[model samples]
Target: MLLQMKKKVLFILISVSFYCGLSQSREVDSLKLSLTNSKIHDTIKIKNCLILAGKYGGFSLDSLKKYTLDAIDLSKKNNDYLLDGGYYFMGVYYSEIGEINKAKESYKKALPLVDSISNKKKFGQILSAYANLLSETNELDEKIAYYTRALKIMESIGDQSKIAFTQYNISNVYRLTGVDTLAIDYLQRALISAEASGQKSLKGHILNNLTIFALKNKDLEKANTYLIESENICKETKLNLLCFHTFLQKGRYLDELKKTLEAENAFLTALKNAKKRGAPQDIMLAYTYLGKHYEEAGHAKKAIQNFEKAQEQDPANAERIMSPFSYMSWSRAERELGNYKKSNEYLLKHVKIMDSLNSEKNKKSLAIAEAKYQTVKKDKEIANQQLELKDKASEIQKKKTQNNYMLGTIVFLTIASILLVFLFKQRQKRKNQELLTLKREFQIKTLESLIEGEEKERFRIAKELHDGVNGDLSAIKYKLSSLLEMNNKVIKEAITMIDDSCKQVRAISHNLVPPSLEKFDLVEAADAYCANLNELNPSIEITFQHLGDVVDMSKKAEVNSFRIIQELVTNSLKHADASNINVQISNRNNLIQMTIEDDGKGFDKTNIESSGIGLSNVQSRIDYLQATVDLISNEAGTSYTIEINKETLNGN
Candidate 1:
């Protein structure tokens, strides 16, 4: 029974995660459409392309690579100097797909151009990417060097976010190299930087890594503290990715502490969150860990199931992200279950992966050795060049002494030219700002016009349904009633059916644009709807209460507020599975406040997709009304409070 409960919880987690991914996919689609339809600057287009590429990288390598190359081409065509940024993305794509050699080449291509870029932020970013590539390939010394360089640049620019990120990467390298002391030191530095930056996401990530280090050292108290802190940050910020990693770390810590049931729940939660982010690497890790847990618990069948799932979800670069132990564990489970052939197959796959890893390690070692040799050779060449320069210095000194006055005059003119250029650039910047502001105003007006048109269309549709379709249904019902005088059995049944059909048509018409809303006010309409809902679904109780005198508002405001309430009620019925619900509205001091509470299993707010269309519809209405909505949810129940100012409603 306990195992069944665990499985159920795990399933819920995965479902929630999958829904979140779908929501994100929809957002990505909208962004793509906007990019395609809009006539933006080439630089903005390039940025959007890169953003899309990063979004797709988790699921589609081909798309990632295509967008990355497109960005590079666009940058070159526009002379944007974003070529280094493009190459950095290319490196990231290659690394993610397990093309180590290609990743290395891309990083090398990006490194030299970093210094030429005008954006210090991009320069720091590229340096960090190069460092990450080095770390991935086990070039520890080079990784540390590049990370340090990136950190210095970030510090010089006073970018605390980048400093924290660089420090985190350096700590990861140290941890991978088994330099525990150095890892802990860098992690502490990262924490300080992250705190100073005031970025919840970065702080959460650093805390999660610190928790892992604490777990590795068997410092249970420290691990728990860090995990709790990280989880809190994730919850507060809705950083699903960080939350997923923290859950995974917590599971491991619990497993070590011998709390098997709690550990199982933690792993399942991790799996759920990973699925939400739709990151293949994270999903694969969660599956691998769960499989291991099940195997250790002597559930061979369950273990095999999870292992198969992990394999199915594994990305093209699975060999890089997946642990060899996953394969070994699967083989063991299969063998134990008396599936010798399958066991052997898994064992062979594990062997192949191990061999490939070994080969890659050897290549990396050789590359490092070659790099060292090249560095020494370059040093010697530099020494030779310095000696030659020294030899020519005496002759150059005599010439310099003769042209000193002329050189000074040239320097002064150069300074004056630079000042003129600076002044001209400043004037151009102001003009550009003006243009940008105008563009923004135009976009805002366009959006508002579109929204207004949408509402007008909805009103037209509602009128048509009510006056046209409902009128036809009413005419038919009246005709049927006249025929009911025949008193035949078929005629009586037909009349009853016609009566039922008429009622349904009227109900549909009312739903489109509630008669109470048009004739009365929002509070009365909501109360009537809630009463009807209670009659229809006696299994679930609903109550509506209103306080104070309701103020008059515009037709649009009334319609939107009613629709928002209707959507919330519909959502509760379909998804909340609550047996009881309460709604209250209060009007005072030129403000209207509405609160809805339900006794149902609360959902993960981080997984926005799980909220579905009903919540989205509610949001749209609230946005139209310019109202404020606040939600509080937990496993026990969910509540929402919305406030609308009467002045705002009047203005609308």
Candidate 2:
């Protein structure tokens, strides 16, 4: 496709040259001749060709300059939003020629037109071009502002491909401003977005830029990854441009890695590739890099040769290109070649250009400031007018002749008296309603407390019957069998039956209420339960620790706390298959802290919330006591921490 474009461009140049030779008048004839070029027929194509021609052609400049104005006028006549784009391109060309005022004027004209365009994708693209033009001179803030606007628009439109380009541009601005980490973030985002969009071409470009950003950030791993991705994309696309870029990037990465031989090879490949493509700009860059590589390797003479080759390829580029960045390579190369005077000269020029770029940027900033001042002034005026209009309306109402002061006073007093009586009645009604609500709440709490007390009493009685009476019954059966001598098989069987019945009854009662927990305090209860648990599961190990002096808690708090602990221990012993458990109790700053940790097969919290009945009961009981419980469980283990305010426990 590029070959086809080259053929077409050649044909147009030849035709225009032929026509100009035949015409008597050169200027008018050259203009007329240019009209026949396909680049002149389509405004979009013409704008693109003008910019491209500026980079390559000598004679194309005059024609491109003329057609740029023509394109702007045509766009306006056609009501095309692209007129803004044309104006931006013209600004770029003028900047290239160092015509600051003309460039500024063109950009000013483009500004509103670009804003008026409703298409977000095109808006983003045009804004990016405008930003790039600003960045050309050292208008750092303006470049950032415009690029930010473009990025936001691209992101809003979900134009993934264009957004990647914007990200790269933002990264460049950050890098120039000495924010390497921020630059890396943007460049990485650009690479990811570009790759996700399946835009291999854009991916390659972002990858190369990201590599540079990472290198600046001193992130060799990130730089190498991006370089590899860039190289792969370049190979896939057969993009010689990207190959040249990534090779240079890899050379820098290798240099940072201290692999000088690999770095040198990469640099040589980049230089060879750039030369093969006949891209003077890229070749010059490659030569500058080679100079740096040689200088680093202690080959000063070879470094100077490479620097000279770079300068020879693009000497005029120092002035002809608006990019403040262009001088960086030249300045470094001149310095290392021991041309201190020339190096300082280039460096001063570079700095001056950068400052001028900043000044131009400041002018735009001043313009924006002026615009904001006018906007605020206009808003104030509008507000003042509105205020005056309101005052006038009030005055007009006041001017009405009716003055019924006495009548109004009488009516107002009567209304006030009636409203006072009505409000009093309403307040009385609300007070009565609140009293009724309080009574209902009190009754509910009384009923709840009574039910809870009854349940506890029943549990205590059941435990006593199981542990005390059932144990006595089993002993009695054993004593009777001993009294009968139990030599006969029938008598022995009957004695075993009685013992089994007693054991079953005791188990049932223990299930109804744990006997040890009822008889002991929280700490003793927990220790005794863990001991019983360890006896039941000999493989399990349980450790208990107590801190602070034990305070006598109310019976309700004690029962609830004991029941919760018992339920937890039972679940751990039965289902957790826990080999090691640690229970800690402490009191600090008027709060009780109980933490239970276990190296168990932890259950998923979500699954437990959905399916675990025992956990639900524990959580409900804790919530009723106004205590806080936090459970952290993963594949490795389970941890439960319960915190109870000592005040809440004491109140019970």
Which numbered prediction scores highest in lDDT against the true structure? Answer: 1
Task: Give the C-alpha miss distance for residue 95 in model 1, angstroms.
Answer: 2.4
Q: After superposition, how far is residue 29 of candidate 1 from its true place, in Å?
A: 9.9
- What would the per-residue lDDT of candidate 2 be over residues 561-619, giving only the tens digit for each residue? 76677667667767677889888878777788888888888888877865352586677
Q: Alpha-carbon error at 156 in model 1, in Å? A: 2.4
The local distance difference test score of each candidate is 0.73, 0.66
Each prediction's TM-score versus the true structure: 0.48, 0.39
What lDDT tens digits, residue by residue, belong to model 1 across residues 268-328? Answer: 9989977875655667778888887888778889889987787677546555556778888
